[model samples]
Target: MKQDNITAKREQEKRIVSLMIRTYCKGRHGTRQGLCPECQALQEYALLRADRCPFMEAKTFCSNCRVHCYKPAMRENIRAVMRYSGPRMMFSHPVLVIQHGIESIREKKRLEKENHEA
Candidate 1:
């Protein structure tokens, strides 16, 4: 993809992850729409990973990446946030959710094809 596309995708990923963390922290951590300290750290770490991702716009969903970049604890925290917020995304941010869903499916298929080829 073009550089512009990569930048756009990175920004989108940042936004999506930020929203998920914020929502999760607000409800479960009792922050009431704001992230608590732990969630704040997780969000920052997630954004850093997304920004530094080698595949950038070419990446599959982070869940499907071959190389796991996040540390175990942070990864689990993110997974929890995702599990809580993913379904809710459809209702809260339908456009972004749909786009990401489609992209995730496509990326999964692509990875499967590569695995088969290998």
Candidate 2:
């Protein structure tokens, strides 16, 4: 993976996780920091996992990946945050929502191609 691609992926993951934290923490935890203590820890863990992703430049949305990297409890917590925040993202972070949607589609296609070739 190129350095630029790695950087871009890290930025994208940071943005997405940040949005999720903002939405979830603000709505549920009633915090302006965009994260409660637990969510803050989870966000840091998630970013770390994304930064070390094996696919590197080829990485897509974590949800679309064949590998499940997050720990079970953290995964469920993040899933809850995403489920609550995903729809809200369109209104709060429209550009990121759109970018992620496009990337997810591309990832799906790539995965399908890999499967077919195999």
Candidate 3:
């Protein structure tokens, strides 16, 4: 029972981390520091290096710097625990749905503001 609980918790964290990565790729601004126009271009170029590379230049800062950085370790840690049941859980687990959904909503607004002013 205890082991199962741990897996469930990790799986949930996996979803949240997935959301964060999606947000980064979908949201970064042109003039934003560590992510200006040239930086963004670099990120586009770095995807090809993901296989044998330590860091993709495009996502290097976000992956390395601890500044709101979403480390891969978090995914490894939580995913090992959660064993996700898929999107259906969003309905089955109302609390997780509400929390992650709200966070995504607020972040969407924030990113919208950034995109506009950029």
- What TM-score, over all chains together, does every model reach? 0.90, 0.86, 0.31
Global lDDT of each model?
0.88, 0.82, 0.42
Candidate 2 clashing pairs?
A: none
RMSD of 2: 1.7
- Tens digits of per-residue lDDT for model 1, 46-79: 9999989998756758887778999999999999
Question: Which candidate number maximizes TM-score?
Answer: 1
**What is the C-alpha lDDT profile of model 3 across 21-115, one tens digit per residue?**
33343343323234444334434333322333322222222223224322365434323323343244465566766775676676667667968
Please list the Cα RMSD from the true structure of every candidate, rounded to 1 decimal place.
1.4, 1.7, 16.2
Q: Per-residue CA lDDT of candidate 2, range 60-104, in tens?
A: 667777798899999998999999999999997798788878978
lDDT of 2: 0.82
Q: Ranking by TM-score, best first?
A: 1, 2, 3
Which 10 consecutive positions of candidate 1 have the poorest summed lDDT? 57-66
Q: Would you list the clashing residue pairs of candidate 1?
A: none
